[model samples]
Target: MSQLFARVVRQAIATFDRKNVASFNKNFSVLKQLVDQLTPCDINLNMDLTTDEAFSRVGKAPVTYVNLMEDEEFEFSVFILRSGFTMPLHDHPVMHGILKVMSGSAMIESFTKEEATGSAGQQLLYDPDAVRIEVVQDEPRLCTNNDESVVLTPTKRNYHEITAVGGVAAFFDILSPPYDSNIPFYGRRKCSYYRVIPRNGESGKRTLERIPPPRDFYCDRGNYEPPDFLRA
Candidate 1:
Protein backbone atom coordinates (compact mmCIF):
# COMPACT_ATOMS: atom_id res chain seq x y z
CA MET A 1 0.00 0.00 0.00
CA SER A 2 1.05 3.58 -0.53
CA GLN A 3 1.77 5.69 2.53
CA LEU A 4 -1.32 7.77 1.91
CA PHE A 5 -3.59 4.74 1.51
CA ALA A 6 -2.14 3.08 4.59
CA ARG A 7 -2.84 6.22 6.55
CA VAL A 8 -6.38 6.22 5.25
CA VAL A 9 -6.88 2.62 6.36
CA ARG A 10 -5.45 3.37 9.77
CA GLN A 11 -7.71 6.38 10.15
CA ALA A 12 -10.74 4.36 9.04
CA ILE A 13 -9.92 1.75 11.66
CA ALA A 14 -9.61 4.47 14.26
CA THR A 15 -12.87 6.07 13.18
CA PHE A 16 -14.97 2.88 13.23
CA ASP A 17 -13.43 1.56 16.44
CA ARG A 18 -14.58 4.61 18.35
CA LYS A 19 -17.55 4.32 20.66
CA ASN A 20 -18.00 8.06 21.07
CA VAL A 21 -19.73 10.04 18.35
CA ALA A 22 -17.40 13.02 18.66
CA SER A 23 -14.31 10.86 18.36
CA PHE A 24 -15.70 8.95 15.43
CA ASN A 25 -16.59 12.17 13.63
CA LYS A 26 -13.15 13.60 14.19
CA ASN A 27 -11.44 10.50 12.85
CA PHE A 28 -13.84 10.27 9.95
CA SER A 29 -13.03 13.81 8.88
CA VAL A 30 -9.36 12.93 8.84
CA LEU A 31 -10.08 9.79 6.90
CA LYS A 32 -12.00 11.72 4.27
CA GLN A 33 -9.21 14.22 3.90
CA LEU A 34 -6.77 11.42 3.24
CA VAL A 35 -9.05 9.72 0.76
CA ASP A 36 -9.74 12.95 -1.08
CA GLN A 37 -6.06 13.39 -1.75
CA LEU A 38 -5.76 10.02 -3.46
CA THR A 39 -5.24 9.62 -7.22
CA PRO A 40 -4.69 6.90 -9.76
CA CYS A 41 -0.95 7.25 -9.28
CA ASP A 42 -1.27 6.63 -5.56
CA ILE A 43 -2.80 3.21 -6.14
CA ASN A 44 -0.74 2.58 -9.29
CA LEU A 45 -3.96 2.18 -11.24
CA ASN A 46 -3.45 0.99 -14.78
CA MET A 47 -4.36 4.12 -16.70
CA ASP A 48 -4.06 2.08 -19.86
CA LEU A 49 -7.16 0.10 -18.95
CA THR A 50 -9.30 3.21 -18.51
CA THR A 51 -9.53 3.92 -22.23
CA ASP A 52 -11.89 2.93 -25.01
CA GLU A 53 -9.45 0.83 -26.99
CA ALA A 54 -8.01 -0.88 -23.93
CA PHE A 55 -11.48 -1.55 -22.50
CA SER A 56 -12.55 -3.19 -25.74
CA ARG A 57 -9.52 -5.48 -25.62
CA VAL A 58 -9.52 -6.83 -22.06
CA GLY A 59 -12.87 -5.82 -20.56
CA LYS A 60 -15.28 -8.68 -21.07
CA ALA A 61 -17.30 -7.81 -17.98
CA PRO A 62 -19.29 -4.61 -17.68
CA VAL A 63 -17.83 -4.06 -14.24
CA THR A 64 -14.84 -5.25 -12.28
CA TYR A 65 -13.62 -4.88 -8.71
CA VAL A 66 -10.40 -5.15 -6.75
CA ASN A 67 -10.69 -6.00 -3.11
CA LEU A 68 -8.13 -4.04 -1.15
CA MET A 69 -9.01 -5.01 2.41
CA GLU A 70 -11.91 -5.89 4.66
CA ASP A 71 -12.52 -6.32 8.35
CA GLU A 72 -15.31 -6.11 10.89
CA GLU A 73 -15.06 -2.35 10.84
CA PHE A 74 -14.92 -1.62 7.10
CA GLU A 75 -14.57 -2.93 3.56
CA PHE A 76 -12.34 -1.20 1.03
CA SER A 77 -12.47 -1.88 -2.68
CA VAL A 78 -12.07 -0.38 -6.12
CA PHE A 79 -14.77 -0.70 -8.79
CA ILE A 80 -14.17 -0.16 -12.49
CA LEU A 81 -17.00 0.40 -14.96
CA ARG A 82 -16.93 0.17 -18.72
CA SER A 83 -18.27 2.99 -20.82
CA GLY A 84 -22.08 3.31 -20.66
CA PHE A 85 -22.33 0.54 -18.02
CA THR A 86 -24.30 1.30 -14.93
CA MET A 87 -24.55 -0.16 -11.47
CA PRO A 88 -28.23 -0.23 -10.64
CA LEU A 89 -29.68 1.68 -7.72
CA HIS A 90 -28.90 -0.11 -4.46
CA ASP A 91 -29.13 0.63 -0.78
CA HIS A 92 -26.56 0.26 1.98
CA PRO A 93 -28.58 -0.44 5.08
CA VAL A 94 -27.16 1.07 8.29
CA MET A 95 -23.76 1.68 6.77
CA HIS A 96 -21.58 4.69 6.02
CA GLY A 97 -19.73 5.04 2.74
CA ILE A 98 -17.20 7.27 0.97
CA LEU A 99 -16.47 7.11 -2.75
CA LYS A 100 -13.61 8.81 -4.58
CA VAL A 101 -13.11 8.71 -8.28
CA MET A 102 -9.64 7.58 -9.33
CA SER A 103 -9.80 7.64 -13.09
CA GLY A 104 -12.00 8.94 -15.95
CA SER A 105 -15.47 10.13 -14.90
CA ALA A 106 -18.87 8.82 -13.80
CA MET A 107 -22.39 10.02 -13.20
CA ILE A 108 -23.94 9.37 -9.80
CA GLU A 109 -27.62 9.52 -8.90
CA SER A 110 -28.54 9.21 -5.24
CA PHE A 111 -31.70 8.86 -3.18
CA THR A 112 -32.78 8.74 0.44
CA LYS A 113 -35.79 7.07 2.01
CA GLU A 114 -38.45 9.56 3.02
CA GLU A 115 -39.49 10.04 6.61
CA ALA A 116 -43.13 9.69 7.55
CA THR A 117 -44.75 13.06 8.10
CA GLY A 118 -48.25 14.50 7.86
CA SER A 119 -49.61 17.86 6.74
CA ALA A 120 -51.47 18.54 10.01
CA GLY A 121 -49.00 17.42 12.70
CA GLN A 122 -50.32 13.83 12.46
CA GLN A 123 -47.95 10.94 11.76
CA LEU A 124 -48.44 9.30 8.37
CA LEU A 125 -48.80 5.56 8.13
CA TYR A 126 -45.63 3.72 7.20
CA ASP A 127 -46.15 0.28 5.64
CA PRO A 128 -43.11 -1.98 5.65
CA ASP A 129 -44.94 -4.74 3.79
CA ALA A 130 -45.68 -2.48 0.86
CA VAL A 131 -42.26 -3.42 -0.54
CA ARG A 132 -42.23 0.09 -1.99
CA ILE A 133 -40.86 3.29 -0.52
CA GLU A 134 -41.09 7.03 -1.04
CA VAL A 135 -37.66 8.50 -1.64
CA VAL A 136 -36.12 11.93 -2.13
CA GLN A 137 -33.97 11.96 -5.23
CA ASP A 138 -30.87 14.10 -5.57
CA GLU A 139 -29.77 15.75 -8.77
CA PRO A 140 -27.43 13.64 -10.82
CA ARG A 141 -23.76 14.62 -10.55
CA LEU A 142 -20.87 14.05 -12.93
CA CYS A 143 -17.79 13.10 -10.95
CA THR A 144 -14.15 12.98 -11.87
CA ASN A 145 -10.91 12.69 -9.96
CA ASN A 146 -10.87 16.42 -9.37
CA ASP A 147 -14.28 16.39 -7.72
CA GLU A 148 -14.74 16.10 -4.00
CA SER A 149 -15.43 12.67 -2.59
CA VAL A 150 -19.07 11.66 -2.16
CA VAL A 151 -20.41 10.54 1.20
CA LEU A 152 -23.46 8.57 2.33
CA THR A 153 -24.66 8.02 5.85
CA PRO A 154 -27.05 5.43 7.24
CA THR A 155 -30.10 7.51 6.46
CA LYS A 156 -29.07 10.30 4.12
CA ARG A 157 -28.46 9.53 0.46
CA ASN A 158 -28.17 5.86 1.38
CA TYR A 159 -29.02 4.56 -2.06
CA HIS A 160 -27.35 5.38 -5.36
CA GLU A 161 -26.65 4.29 -8.95
CA ILE A 162 -23.32 4.81 -10.72
CA THR A 163 -22.62 4.88 -14.44
CA ALA A 164 -19.47 5.40 -16.41
CA VAL A 165 -19.51 8.69 -18.27
CA GLY A 166 -17.49 9.17 -21.43
CA GLY A 167 -15.12 6.25 -21.07
CA VAL A 168 -14.03 3.62 -18.59
CA ALA A 169 -14.04 4.88 -15.03
CA ALA A 170 -12.66 3.61 -11.72
CA PHE A 171 -13.23 4.60 -8.12
CA PHE A 172 -12.20 3.66 -4.62
CA ASP A 173 -14.93 2.88 -2.13
CA ILE A 174 -14.94 2.56 1.64
CA LEU A 175 -17.93 1.18 3.47
CA SER A 176 -17.85 1.24 7.25
CA PRO A 177 -19.51 -1.35 9.44
CA PRO A 178 -19.75 -3.55 6.41
CA TYR A 179 -22.88 -5.48 5.50
CA ASP A 180 -22.51 -8.86 7.14
CA SER A 181 -24.17 -11.26 9.57
CA ASN A 182 -21.97 -9.87 12.34
CA ILE A 183 -23.72 -6.49 12.30
CA PRO A 184 -25.59 -5.79 15.52
CA PHE A 185 -29.32 -5.13 15.66
CA TYR A 186 -29.71 -5.51 11.88
CA GLY A 187 -28.71 -9.09 11.27
CA ARG A 188 -27.08 -9.95 7.96
CA ARG A 189 -27.40 -6.56 6.29
CA LYS A 190 -27.44 -7.39 2.60
CA CYS A 191 -27.65 -5.04 -0.38
CA SER A 192 -31.10 -4.52 -1.89
CA TYR A 193 -31.84 -3.29 -5.42
CA TYR A 194 -34.59 -0.87 -6.42
CA ARG A 195 -36.32 0.47 -9.50
CA VAL A 196 -38.16 3.71 -9.98
CA ILE A 197 -41.95 3.46 -9.71
CA PRO A 198 -43.62 5.73 -12.22
CA ARG A 199 -45.59 8.55 -10.69
CA ASN A 200 -49.21 8.56 -11.87
CA GLY A 201 -50.21 12.24 -11.75
CA GLU A 202 -48.07 12.65 -8.62
CA SER A 203 -45.92 15.67 -9.41
CA GLY A 204 -43.48 15.87 -6.52
CA LYS A 205 -43.49 12.47 -4.87
CA ARG A 206 -41.12 9.80 -6.14
CA THR A 207 -41.31 6.12 -5.24
CA LEU A 208 -39.02 3.14 -5.65
CA GLU A 209 -39.95 -0.52 -5.71
CA ARG A 210 -37.78 -3.32 -4.46
CA ILE A 211 -36.41 -5.52 -7.23
CA PRO A 212 -34.08 -8.48 -7.61
CA PRO A 213 -30.50 -7.72 -8.56
CA PRO A 214 -30.14 -7.22 -12.30
CA ARG A 215 -29.25 -10.46 -14.02
CA ASP A 216 -27.24 -8.62 -16.65
CA PHE A 217 -25.13 -6.85 -14.03
CA TYR A 218 -22.18 -8.73 -12.64
CA CYS A 219 -18.65 -7.94 -11.51
CA ASP A 220 -15.47 -9.83 -12.17
CA ARG A 221 -12.67 -9.91 -9.63
CA GLY A 222 -9.39 -8.25 -10.51
CA ASN A 223 -5.98 -8.50 -8.87
CA TYR A 224 -5.00 -5.62 -6.61
CA GLU A 225 -1.37 -4.61 -6.55
CA PRO A 226 -0.13 -2.15 -4.00
CA PRO A 227 1.62 0.95 -5.30
CA ASP A 228 5.40 1.05 -5.37
CA PHE A 229 5.45 4.16 -3.24
CA LEU A 230 5.22 2.01 -0.12
CA ARG A 231 5.06 -1.59 1.00
CA ALA A 232 3.10 -3.23 3.78
Candidate 2:
Protein backbone atom coordinates (compact mmCIF):
# COMPACT_ATOMS: atom_id res chain seq x y z
CA MET A 1 0.00 0.00 0.00
CA SER A 2 1.08 3.57 -0.51
CA GLN A 3 2.34 5.49 2.51
CA LEU A 4 -0.55 7.93 2.45
CA PHE A 5 -3.09 5.11 2.20
CA ALA A 6 -1.40 3.44 5.13
CA ARG A 7 -1.64 6.59 7.21
CA VAL A 8 -5.37 7.09 6.74
CA VAL A 9 -6.14 3.43 7.37
CA ARG A 10 -4.11 3.54 10.55
CA GLN A 11 -5.86 6.67 11.75
CA ALA A 12 -9.29 5.20 11.04
CA ILE A 13 -8.52 2.01 12.91
CA ALA A 14 -7.12 3.96 15.84
CA THR A 15 -10.44 5.70 16.23
CA PHE A 16 -12.45 2.48 16.67
CA ASP A 17 -12.44 2.08 20.41
CA ARG A 18 -15.67 2.23 22.47
CA LYS A 19 -14.81 5.57 24.04
CA ASN A 20 -14.24 7.22 20.65
CA VAL A 21 -17.67 8.26 19.39
CA ALA A 22 -16.93 11.80 20.41
CA SER A 23 -13.50 11.45 18.90
CA PHE A 24 -14.89 9.82 15.76
CA ASN A 25 -17.36 12.63 15.37
CA LYS A 26 -14.51 15.04 15.75
CA ASN A 27 -12.29 13.13 13.37
CA PHE A 28 -14.18 14.60 10.42
CA SER A 29 -12.45 17.87 11.06
CA VAL A 30 -9.13 16.15 10.78
CA LEU A 31 -10.43 14.19 7.83
CA LYS A 32 -11.35 17.45 6.19
CA GLN A 33 -7.91 18.76 6.80
CA LEU A 34 -6.42 15.69 5.21
CA VAL A 35 -8.73 16.20 2.28
CA ASP A 36 -7.63 19.77 1.84
CA GLN A 37 -4.05 18.71 1.98
CA LEU A 38 -4.58 16.34 -0.92
CA THR A 39 -4.72 17.62 -4.48
CA PRO A 40 -6.28 15.44 -7.17
CA CYS A 41 -3.30 16.42 -9.27
CA ASP A 42 -0.98 14.65 -6.84
CA ILE A 43 -3.11 11.57 -6.22
CA ASN A 44 -2.75 8.63 -8.57
CA LEU A 45 -6.00 6.93 -9.53
CA ASN A 46 -5.57 3.33 -8.53
CA MET A 47 -6.32 1.37 -11.72
CA ASP A 48 -4.35 -1.65 -10.65
CA LEU A 49 -6.34 -4.85 -10.13
CA THR A 50 -3.70 -7.08 -8.58
CA THR A 51 -4.25 -5.52 -5.19
CA ASP A 52 -7.73 -6.81 -4.38
CA GLU A 53 -9.67 -9.99 -4.93
CA ALA A 54 -12.90 -8.23 -5.89
CA PHE A 55 -11.03 -5.79 -8.07
CA SER A 56 -8.87 -8.48 -9.61
CA ARG A 57 -11.99 -9.94 -11.07
CA VAL A 58 -12.98 -6.66 -12.66
CA GLY A 59 -9.59 -5.07 -13.37
CA LYS A 60 -10.35 -2.16 -11.04
CA ALA A 61 -11.58 -2.18 -7.49
CA PRO A 62 -12.34 0.31 -4.82
CA VAL A 63 -9.42 1.12 -2.59
CA THR A 64 -8.84 -1.56 0.04
CA TYR A 65 -9.03 -0.65 3.71
CA VAL A 66 -8.30 -2.74 6.74
CA ASN A 67 -10.45 -1.75 9.69
CA LEU A 68 -7.95 -2.32 12.47
CA MET A 69 -10.74 -3.32 14.78
CA GLU A 70 -13.38 -5.51 13.22
CA ASP A 71 -16.29 -5.90 15.64
CA GLU A 72 -19.76 -4.59 16.41
CA GLU A 73 -18.42 -1.18 17.25
CA PHE A 74 -16.95 -0.14 13.88
CA GLU A 75 -15.69 -1.15 10.44
CA PHE A 76 -13.94 0.87 7.74
CA SER A 77 -13.12 0.59 4.01
CA VAL A 78 -11.90 2.65 1.10
CA PHE A 79 -14.28 2.65 -1.88
CA ILE A 80 -13.10 3.42 -5.39
CA LEU A 81 -15.78 3.32 -8.05
CA ARG A 82 -15.29 3.97 -11.73
CA SER A 83 -17.28 6.60 -13.52
CA GLY A 84 -20.83 5.36 -14.20
CA PHE A 85 -20.66 2.57 -11.66
CA THR A 86 -23.50 2.00 -9.27
CA MET A 87 -23.82 0.18 -5.97
CA PRO A 88 -27.46 -0.77 -5.80
CA LEU A 89 -29.89 0.01 -3.01
CA HIS A 90 -29.49 -2.33 -0.10
CA ASP A 91 -29.73 -2.33 3.67
CA HIS A 92 -27.23 -3.11 6.32
CA PRO A 93 -29.16 -5.54 8.52
CA VAL A 94 -27.87 -3.92 11.71
CA MET A 95 -25.22 -1.30 11.25
CA HIS A 96 -24.13 2.32 10.94
CA GLY A 97 -21.61 3.71 8.51
CA ILE A 98 -19.84 6.82 7.24
CA LEU A 99 -18.84 7.73 3.66
CA LYS A 100 -16.12 10.32 3.09
CA VAL A 101 -15.49 11.11 -0.53
CA MET A 102 -11.81 11.22 -1.35
CA SER A 103 -11.99 12.17 -4.98
CA GLY A 104 -14.52 12.87 -7.75
CA SER A 105 -18.30 12.78 -7.16
CA ALA A 106 -21.27 10.45 -6.71
CA MET A 107 -25.06 10.49 -6.65
CA ILE A 108 -26.24 8.49 -3.65
CA GLU A 109 -29.92 7.74 -3.08
CA SER A 110 -31.05 6.24 0.19
CA PHE A 111 -34.40 4.83 1.36
CA THR A 112 -35.66 4.55 4.89
CA LYS A 113 -36.81 1.08 5.89
CA GLU A 114 -40.54 0.89 6.60
CA GLU A 115 -43.35 -1.58 7.25
CA ALA A 116 -44.01 -4.30 4.68
CA THR A 117 -47.42 -5.56 3.44
CA GLY A 118 -47.43 -9.05 2.03
CA SER A 119 -47.52 -12.79 2.69
CA ALA A 120 -44.79 -15.45 2.56
CA GLY A 121 -43.41 -16.25 -0.94
CA GLN A 122 -45.11 -13.16 -2.22
CA GLN A 123 -43.70 -9.86 -3.34
CA LEU A 124 -43.10 -7.45 -0.44
CA LEU A 125 -44.90 -4.15 -0.55
CA TYR A 126 -42.85 -1.28 0.81
CA ASP A 127 -44.67 1.65 2.30
CA PRO A 128 -44.44 4.52 -0.17
CA ASP A 129 -45.47 7.00 2.49
CA ALA A 130 -44.43 6.12 5.99
CA VAL A 131 -43.80 8.40 8.92
CA ARG A 132 -40.34 6.89 9.27
CA ILE A 133 -39.28 7.56 5.67
CA GLU A 134 -36.17 9.65 5.12
CA VAL A 135 -34.12 10.10 1.94
CA VAL A 136 -30.68 11.59 1.27
CA GLN A 137 -31.89 14.63 -0.61
CA ASP A 138 -28.36 15.95 -0.88
CA GLU A 139 -26.78 12.66 -0.28
CA PRO A 140 -25.14 11.14 -3.29
CA ARG A 141 -24.48 14.80 -3.20
CA LEU A 142 -21.60 16.01 -5.30
CA CYS A 143 -18.61 15.52 -3.04
CA THR A 144 -15.20 16.44 -4.24
CA ASN A 145 -11.91 17.40 -2.59
CA ASN A 146 -12.97 16.92 1.05
CA ASP A 147 -16.47 18.30 1.30
CA GLU A 148 -18.53 17.23 4.32
CA SER A 149 -18.60 13.46 4.53
CA VAL A 150 -21.79 11.33 4.34
CA VAL A 151 -22.71 9.49 7.50
CA LEU A 152 -25.25 6.65 7.82
CA THR A 153 -26.69 4.75 10.75
CA PRO A 154 -29.00 1.75 10.70
CA THR A 155 -31.72 3.76 12.37
CA LYS A 156 -31.40 7.18 10.77
CA ARG A 157 -29.80 6.31 7.45
CA ASN A 158 -30.10 2.97 5.70
CA TYR A 159 -30.98 1.44 2.33
CA HIS A 160 -28.92 3.77 0.14
CA GLU A 161 -27.74 3.43 -3.45
CA ILE A 162 -24.51 4.94 -4.79
CA THR A 163 -23.63 5.90 -8.35
CA ALA A 164 -20.40 7.37 -9.64
CA VAL A 165 -20.72 10.36 -11.87
CA GLY A 166 -18.16 12.34 -13.91
CA GLY A 167 -14.76 10.85 -13.10
CA VAL A 168 -13.74 8.06 -10.81
CA ALA A 169 -14.82 8.62 -7.21
CA ALA A 170 -13.25 7.31 -4.07
CA PHE A 171 -14.49 7.44 -0.49
CA PHE A 172 -13.68 6.13 2.94
CA ASP A 173 -16.44 4.02 4.46
CA ILE A 174 -16.85 3.04 8.09
CA LEU A 175 -19.53 0.59 9.12
CA SER A 176 -20.00 -1.01 12.48
CA PRO A 177 -19.33 -4.77 12.60
CA PRO A 178 -19.91 -5.21 8.84
CA TYR A 179 -23.01 -6.99 7.46
CA ASP A 180 -24.61 -10.37 8.11
CA SER A 181 -27.68 -11.79 6.26
CA ASN A 182 -29.25 -14.14 8.80
CA ILE A 183 -31.24 -11.36 10.47
CA PRO A 184 -34.89 -10.82 9.38
CA PHE A 185 -36.40 -7.46 8.28
CA TYR A 186 -39.66 -6.91 10.31
CA GLY A 187 -40.15 -7.57 13.98
CA ARG A 188 -39.82 -5.94 17.41
CA ARG A 189 -38.71 -4.64 15.03
CA LYS A 190 -37.38 -5.81 11.69
CA CYS A 191 -36.34 -3.71 8.69
CA SER A 192 -38.86 -2.56 6.06
CA TYR A 193 -38.71 -1.09 2.54
CA TYR A 194 -40.30 2.06 1.07
CA ARG A 195 -40.58 3.96 -2.19
CA VAL A 196 -40.51 7.70 -2.89
CA ILE A 197 -43.15 10.01 -4.34
CA PRO A 198 -43.35 13.72 -5.04
CA ARG A 199 -45.01 15.23 -2.01
CA ASN A 200 -46.33 18.35 -3.77
CA GLY A 201 -45.77 17.56 -7.45
CA GLU A 202 -42.83 19.91 -7.21
CA SER A 203 -39.71 19.46 -9.32
CA GLY A 204 -37.81 17.52 -6.67
CA LYS A 205 -39.73 17.59 -3.44
CA ARG A 206 -40.31 13.94 -2.51
CA THR A 207 -42.24 11.98 0.09
CA LEU A 208 -42.50 8.28 0.81
CA GLU A 209 -45.16 6.63 -1.35
CA ARG A 210 -46.84 4.04 0.80
CA ILE A 211 -47.83 0.94 -1.12
CA PRO A 212 -51.42 -0.05 -0.34
CA PRO A 213 -51.04 -3.53 -1.79
CA PRO A 214 -47.99 -5.79 -1.97
CA ARG A 215 -45.92 -5.66 -5.15
CA ASP A 216 -42.63 -6.96 -6.46
CA PHE A 217 -39.67 -5.28 -8.07
CA TYR A 218 -36.46 -6.67 -9.45
CA CYS A 219 -33.21 -6.03 -7.63
CA ASP A 220 -30.43 -5.02 -9.99
CA ARG A 221 -27.21 -6.81 -9.18
CA GLY A 222 -25.15 -4.92 -11.81
CA ASN A 223 -23.11 -6.12 -14.75
CA TYR A 224 -19.34 -5.72 -14.74
CA GLU A 225 -16.79 -7.57 -16.81
CA PRO A 226 -13.01 -7.68 -16.96
CA PRO A 227 -11.49 -5.55 -19.68
CA ASP A 228 -9.07 -7.19 -22.05
CA PHE A 229 -5.93 -6.52 -20.10
CA LEU A 230 -4.12 -9.32 -21.90
CA ARG A 231 -5.42 -8.92 -25.41
CA ALA A 232 -3.23 -10.30 -28.16
| Top of the candidates by TM-score | 1
TM-score of 2: 0.49
lDDT of each: 0.80, 0.49
lDDT, candidate 1, 118-231, per-residue tens = 576644333324478788787788999999899988777888999998888899999987776356435666777889875778664579898989997888877667654334
Worst 10 residues of 1 by lDDT: 121-130
Error of 1 at 51 (Å): 3.2
Clashing pairs in 1: none
Off by more than 4 A, model 1: 57-59, 116-130, 200-204, 227-232
Candidate 2 per-residue lDDT over residues 153-217, each given as its tens digit: 55545666667677666665666545542224522223334456555554444455433322322
Provide the lDDT at 123 for model 2.
33
Model 1: what TM-score? Answer: 0.86
Cα misplacement distance, residue 189 of candidate 2 (Å): 12
TM-score of every prediction relative to native: 0.86, 0.49
